[model samples]
Target: MAQKSEIEWTDATWNPVTGCTKIGPGCDHCYAERFAERWRGIPGHPYEQGFDLRVWPERLDQPKRWKKPRMIFVNSMSDLFHKEIPRKFIDQVFETMESAHWHVFQVLTKRSSLMRNYIRKRYSDRSVPSNIWLGVSVEDKPHASRIEHLKQINSPARFISFEPLLGPVGEIDLKDIAWAIVGGESGPQARPMAEEWVVEIRNLCERDEVEFFFKQWGGPRPKSGGRLLDGVEWNGFPWQMVPEPILERLAS
Candidate 1:
């Protein structure tokens, strides 16, 4: 069975791989890491190893088994393109996604270059499957370059996550992007997010005709500050990128 998710954008989570090492500031107070570590030493717990990188071949076909069509967040607990994961395992993951064409798979990663390279090599002779949406996480202005990497990919379903928005992401282009989700960091030590910073990105998304979603104004908890931006909630989604069959089912 698929693990239901609380994330606003997706319906469920699929983690064939679990646990990850931080790669940037966005990962500093990772919610996944914190959640996994809590079960570190509990016998028979899924996270007994406590955020240590591990691959579960058994979980590879979870999506295929779920007959109902739904949006699945791929590897919510870990980055599928993390350096330590074997290329063979990554291949298996992609194979499952490609075969499970009934669902939309949201694959996000901080290793932008790796994801770009892998996608290029895997789909060199064809386009990426529309069901597989690729994205990169950018925490600040410096990491905005990841967007450039994402733009190079050949998929029309590309998106970005600016969650844990640590600092302003200055002027950046969102051309050819399908969607963007922005939010402040949450947790015990959540950092504050500025209104101007979010407005800047929302304006950019509008200018580029990209979908904009304001996830939260995060604080001690995800809902502490409420998600209203200028007295409204932004729940933009790229429906055009979803496959026709999936779209029909979702709408039904």
Candidate 2:
């Protein structure tokens, strides 16, 4: 993983754990899997075993080494709540996040139920730290239930990734959601995303006053079709939930 990232929304990526399995249609053309597998069997490569669900305890303390504050995308290459991962290892990850309060940790997962259940048990008596944002990946209408699972969490900094949006999400509530990111899929086998699909979610984000960001219109490449929706770039982000200390660091 890279300390600096090109992801339009986030400043950096921190992958203390890497590798994942395909759990849904969204995982069909995972860029991470493709990249990791290419280097499989090559001696000494980080992904030498390919995308086979591996954890790096040595990397657990990575975030603490970065003295400057950053928007760290936790596990950009894998799903943190993957059932294969041990609870003790996951606890270590959380401990680092809690200790490194200066940075904002964006934790996302396709395993919504697992994530919700874990969060509830971990912080049962208190609230999820504001600096640690929680979100889910939604690709189509059927998976919209993940949104409800995400809503059950007590975190205020909640968001959704309607990326590689395979189909329209239909009518769904955006209440309690702080941010929403919409984008088309990118890869050699990239699927076409209808303009109407983007508009439908954008309209809802407007209605609910949720910060909305249009990442890109995918093709063979991520920026192939550009990120314009009705002749404008939608770069909405939820700054209200950002802890003032982090904001102050960012401003400096």
How high is the CA lDDT of each candidate model? 0.95, 0.95
| Residue 51, model 1: Cα distance from true site in angstroms | 0.3
Give the TM-scores of the predictions, in the order they appear.
0.99, 0.99
Model 1: ten consecutive residues of lowest lDDT:
1-10
Q: On residues 110-208, what C-alpha lDDT tens digit does candidate 1 reach at each position? A: 999999999999999999999999999999999999999999898899999999898889999998999999999989999899999999999999999
Worst 10 residues of 2 by lDDT: 1-10
Shift in Å, residue 175, candidate 1: 0.5
Candidate 2: list runs displaced more than 4 Å.
Answer: none
For model 2, which pairs clash? Answer: none
In candidate 1, stretches whose alpha carbon ends up further than 4 angstroms from where it belongs are: none
Query: What lDDT score goes with residue 82 in model 2?
Result: 98
